[model samples]
Target: MKKMKWALLMVVVLVLAACSTEQPGSKSSSDNEDAGKDGDKEFKIGLSVSTLNNPFFVTLSEGAKEQAKESGAKIIVVDAQDDASKQASDVEDLIQQGVDLLIINPTDSEAVVSAVESANNSNIPVITVDRSAEGGEVVSHIASDNKAGGVLAGEYLLELLGENAKVAELEGIAGSSAARDRGEGFNEAVDGKVDIVAKQTANFNRAEGLTVMENILQANPEITGVFAHNDEMALGALEAIQSAGKDIVVIGFDATDDAVKSVKDGKLAATIAQKPEEIGKKAMEAAVAVLNGEDVDADIPVDLELIKE
Candidate 1:
């Protein structure tokens, strides 16, 4: 009888252990691991935008947010306001929120490395959109070919201006990959063919673009063409040129709404369309793939096109 009682107690203990392992709130190591799989728990994604002040970044954010809703995923977007330190702080806040994945559009490539490394330390996958981070592990990068877009702008400008055409370049923010790569490709295409009269950094702001272009115009009065790293600067430069009563062929990058309207109105010459919305959608898709533990391309390239009226 004693032996029977001992066996019954052991069985009861084993049953209780089994039940405890699968309690109402307990999750197994493999349970709800793949967010893309059916009936799994929803995944949370964090997006760090450089700045939403620009229409380009605003459209990009809209695309990502829309796709997140469609995919039944939660997304948190933080704007850096073009401040690198603010971006870093935003990323730390995202990390504290326990987001499953991170997508960053860096204000500066080098400044974003520490933020990326922080996500890496927490074992969270990262994807960079529009601009790149200079260091750390990233699951994927989604952007248009900035260098190729620059080359397109250069080639088109040369076609319009012909030989010996003097041009001024309005550069984007310093230490940004988009600025560097675009400048490289533009220089490669126009070197020895055209004279770049004045090149200045406008920090990708319209006000600064106008001020810098005003300065360049004052210094180099004979320039006939201009190539701005982005449309904001291009539009600003156009304003300065119009005010100075100069007829310069201004080519810009990123066909933002204002730039497109300017082109249509014959106020701006041309622009390279980076398709910021597509880039955002692609970044969101990559985030989902990373959360699903699926393999994704290291570099995802969106198509680019030149827009002119």
Candidate 2:
């Protein structure tokens, strides 16, 4: 009787141990499947931007994040700090990380082509924002009409000064498409009517704009108007004008909050507003469409508006 009782106890202990092992294993497998169903399966995207120092790009980043969260995709953002080589390296790292898509705001239009092409060869789609690559077949490009913004600035300046005023121009990055297009359009709109007294490249930086505008003021003190390619430069020019005790009319692009306030305070004349948020939202939406095997337009142009306080 004693031997039989011990055997029964041993059998019961072994059965309980076996049941415990199977239960945890089954639960773990189910948990892994749940992870996949919750869309946490490691879908990643790479976003390379020119700079995060600028408010415009900050807004763009926010918009992208909003859209990406809605689609359940993870985004890795890299700030190039306005350096082309750094941007290239960042993109390479993203490629190595096996990102599903690449979104770039090229610091230099032509410098980013090879990096984009590399991704293309690896079967990854590349999308451009604001700035474009010179010779690459990107999946999509989203931007505002920079040239039209410039033309609007030019026309507004001409109207303010009666089409025969002396004007100074503050240009952004020299080789950038935004700089070139805006300058060209402004020049065209005011062709043979207004005199462009000085045109200098401030590299789209505020401090540089202040120095450049000061030099222009010294060279041509009688200038009636100033046009800057971006709000940062425009604000700088405004400061220089105020410091020099000049009352020159100033107009800028990128209708940033500060720029709008300047206009309201009667310091700045007008500014063209580019919809950064809209650009960002649209880019993400386009990325989703591409992922879904749906066709998207090569160029998505966001509209611009001139804000005059």
Candidate 3:
């Protein structure tokens, strides 16, 4: 009788342990893990933007937000402030929130590999915008053909200034695909035709562009034209040119509103126009498509236009 009583106690304890181990508010994996699989349920998209300091990226975010509103989907935007580690951390937090899909604009291509891997592990599809990642499974990359735009700038500069004209280059941020590809295409187009007297990096910043261009002009005052990777740097170069009282033709990329106005005012010579809003909208749509299990291309190139007065 004592042995039976002890057995009963042991059984009760075991049952209590089992009950305590059960997760609180737990549901079946099938119900929670695949909520948006059929395209009927609302999707939650995670957007990781590199930085919002520039007006260009700010406009991109507005585009994404607009599309999300129209589709009745939820979007979470995280700013990395140009820090790779911060971006990775933001991505982890986004995954913990159970986002249905991810759209990443990496601060650095190689540095974002770990973040991409984490998303892959969580079984979430990734779509990169503006900049791309070196590793992980990216379903799609959406942006304009930066190299082609560079070629256009180079050809236009060549036409404006004779082949024998000397020129200086105001480069964009180092290690960015935009800077690398734009430089390559421009060099190829102007090969042996024009003299690149002074080429240096301005880090795709307006202040840096001003300082660097000023110094370059001091060394090679004969430079007749300039090719800046982006509009910010080009604007800086324009300011420096004006300060030096130099009649130099400056070409910029990414026709931001200010750049267009500058061109119209005869301050800046020309700029390349990229459909930034289109890129953002397409990226958001692609994330939705991935959630719905629809097909998508690896690379989607937006159209580019040359803006000049």
Candidate 4:
């Protein structure tokens, strides 16, 4: 009887040991912990773009979307339609959706401050892309050096036109940091070297640029060069100049697809390449880093290049 009882006890001990041992294709407690550390949970990111009408912003959004997919995150994109109030509303809606983070390309720099602050109030980090907010806490600002790009445009225009060059400026939307910085740099580079016949705002609209360029041409018939804040305006101005039978060295920013083709076709004089897609990729990476509690630079700059025919 003692032997039988001892054998039963040994059998019970062996059963318990087998039960505790991990089997093939079975997950142990440590395996589950490791899976958790790998971040099975998907993070949602909100992207508020100023406008998608421009091909540049469209490419930028596409880049961010691709990065989000690769990083196992979701991104929601909203278009402001170049309306500051609408952009603010879109941001409020995004905040209500409990987005983990926000990437904003503001229609207007000053108008976006309130939206940025709202994201800040909710403890959600904000990343600015291509444009910046005048105020509010931003985890990162990703863009090219607009002022430097402008200087490059100016210097190249000077090279093409030389001294005594009479140029007109086609400015972008009012209250935009891009317009302000680019204009400042361009003016600084060409100050006292060229005759700035006319400078006006085209609101960065191609049609408006056409109209504005037409008016500028009428007012300054001797205009020999043009510097538009963006490619849309530059292309518009090009159309106007071509129609008027005038030969003007038109320099544009944001070497968009159309602008690049124009340069290759010898229609556009030159353009500053901002690599909008890269800017978008960097912004998404920064968003992921911020969510992972990793430190990112306050300002992230993409490379810029001068594209000439």
Candidate 5:
């Protein structure tokens, strides 16, 4: 009887040890499976924008957020309100958060380079949307072809003005990729063809556009047409033209709802329509691909449309 009891105790100890080791391994495998299915284990992205004040950027944000939700990834969105330093700080904060990917529409391309470098050092992939940083190897860049859109605007303006009219150009924020590229294309289209009497920068603001248009009008009273880099500035220029009692044809970009209505109402002539929602969707999709270790192109160009009424 003593031998039987000792044998039974030994059997029980062996059984318990076997159960303990098997249970932990099973649990670990189950946890790994759950992480894979839900993508909750190690996927996060960050999006930083110059400002949320513009409806265009707001739409972009909404699309990105929706896509991130569907992909089971966390996205941190930061708005810089057009402040370059704030944008840099926001990127730094996202980097510290250990994000797996970064998407940025920089306030100032040059100023955001260092912040992008910080993320690159951490092995995080960076994607630029709508705007680009000056010096960086971003995994992907998604935006409308601003230069092509500008050429379209110029050609449309020339057609509306009967091919020989004096025009004024209202530029966006200085030193921006959009501003430089769009101006280049516009000048190319209008070179030796039309009279660009005055050119000025409006910083892509409505009030500044109004003030700058007022100055241009003082210098060249016969300005028959106006070309603003964006619709907000175009609207401002329209207001200034109306206030000055001058009948001028105007063209703009980024056909916002207000700009579209203005075109319908005959207040503005035409605009180049860029699909902001599509831009947002593409950015998020590229981000997910990068997270999954898929290869993507460095530049993704969204097509632009010309809107006329």
Candidate 6:
């Protein structure tokens, strides 16, 4: 009987202890279970820009940073310095930082697509700003319509220089989406009306623009107008034209700070102004939306306008 009573007491004690040990309202357990259904991740974005060397890209970066500040989110920016290989390495580094999302302004659309694909393979959503990737699963692309801007520039150039005018074409980087689209639209607008005396790629650099424009001027002294893809190139072309003592009307894209001032000063005749800041902000916002698992448009185009003195 004593042994039976002892065994019964031990059973009751074990039952009480088990009941006490039950974690009915444990925060960690419930939190882990609800993580997928109810919780959001700590927001962090990776912005990989082609180059911070240009004021346009710098303004873009500032815009994205400002938007992130408003949302209390963090962004990690990497500058590729216009190097495609370096851009890919930078993307990998950002991935190692555990960035929740990625924004890429590609140096070269096709070259950057590899990095973009890697991000996609990792299940990280990518939003391209200003330049779209040639190949990748991009969540969204925020940019101005480059083709339309080019057409606008071409039409305006025709109005300024007139039909049967000799013009030199200053192209941007080869294999870039911007260059391709702009060239396509410009060609469509001016193929029959304008005579392209010299078409050369300056790689969208100011110094190169000067050198290339000099060569084109040397070859075609009859060139009456210059069409540069960007302002930096246009400024360089302006310098070259002034040096040659030629009265050539210069039109450029990207109404950057220098370009705007130049336009005001009547140096550069006109430039197509794309809202780069708005593009940056919209891109960052799109990334946030994607992180939250909300639906977003695949293409989000910003507005463009012509800026003239």
The TM-score ranking, best first, is 5, 4, 1, 2, 6, 3
The whole-model lDDT of each prediction reads 0.92, 0.89, 0.89, 0.93, 0.87, 0.89
> How does candidate 6 score on lDDT?
0.89
lDDT of 2 at 184: 92
- lDDT string for model 5 (1-309, tens) is 999999999999999898875654365666655363254564678999888977778888888988877777778999989888898899889988888899999877788898888888888899999888898669999999999999999888888886668999999888678888788888888888899989999977788889999999999998899999988899999999999999999999888888999999989999888888888889998998888879998899998999999
Candidate 4 per-residue C-alpha lDDT over 1-309 given as tens digits, one digit per residue, 9 for 90 to 100 = 999999999999999988887777887676555232255556789999999998889999999998988888889999999999999999999999999999999999999999999999999999999988999999899999999998999999999999778999999999999999899999989999999989999988888999999999998999999999999999999999999998889999999999999999999999999999999999999999999899999999999999998
Residue 82's lDDT in candidate 5: 82
Better of 1 and 6 by TM-score: 1
Model 2 quality (TM-score): 0.88
Regions of candidate 1 where Cα sits further than 4 Å from its true position: 1-37
Better TM-score candidate (1, 3):
1
**Model 4 regions lying over 4 Å from their true place:** 1-37
Report the Cα lDDT for residue 30, model 6: 50
| Reference-based TM-score, model 6 | 0.87
TM-score of 1: 0.89
Error of 6 at 155 (Å): 0.3
lDDT of 1 by residue, 170-265 (tens): 999999999998988899899999999899999888888899999999999999999999999998999999999999999999999999999999
Count of steric clashes across candidates, in order: 0, 0, 0, 0, 0, 0
The top-ranked prediction according to lDDT is 4
The C-alpha stretches of model 5 lying farther than 4 A from their native spots are 1-42
**Superposed model 3: Cα runs more than 4 Å off:** 1-39
Instruction: Return the candidate ranking by lDDT, descending.
Output: 4, 1, 6, 3, 2, 5
Model 3 TM-score?
0.85
TM-scores for every candidate against the unseen true structure: 0.89, 0.88, 0.85, 0.89, 0.89, 0.87
Model 1, residue pairs in steric clash: none
